[model samples]
Target: MANSVFGITDENGNFTIELPSWLHATPNLEKACAVKVIQLPLDSVCRLRHGPSSSHGIHLSSSEDGFRTYTTGWIQLQQHDTK
Candidate 1:
């Protein structure tokens, strides 16, 4: 399957996550999934610790075919401050 996760960063430095294909295959699809988004400060070591963290991103995990699949998407930081 070509399940994928996408992330979009807004002008305010916030992020929006796009559901995977498998999760939205049906009109009333309900599958277990996990999403994580972390905002890193500019020029911070936190990014290194997190392996090049993005200003906006998403992490997704779902069960499929007796196995779990994970996907991620990274978005560049916006100029405007969201906080």
Candidate 2:
């Protein structure tokens, strides 16, 4: 995963994460491991963390099998009610 800067979680519990300066400036940068955009059912929400610092990186355990990827800046995640 690409190195990421720190992020802030608002009082409303909304997280605002920023990509590294290089990635931000060049949105077309090829995918490394970091996710550019993701939308999951509230039920699917598990744990969120910055990738590891040493080597193994942050371990993400999820019930979902995997994710689908498309060209950068061209994908839109549809929002639906999980209830």
Top TM-score prediction, candidate number: 1
Candidate 2 lDDT over residue span 1-83, tens digit each: 23655544354434445445565444434434333323233663332342223122222233244332322222233333357
For each of the candidates, give the backbone clash count. 0, 2
Candidate 2 regions with alpha-carbon error over 4 angstroms: 27-83
Give a tens-digit lDDT track for model 1, residues 1-83.
25545565465544455565566554423234433444456653433333343232324357677543444444333344345
Clashing pairs for predicted structure model 2, backbone only: 52-57, 52-58
Q: Model 2 RMSD to the real structure? A: 13.6
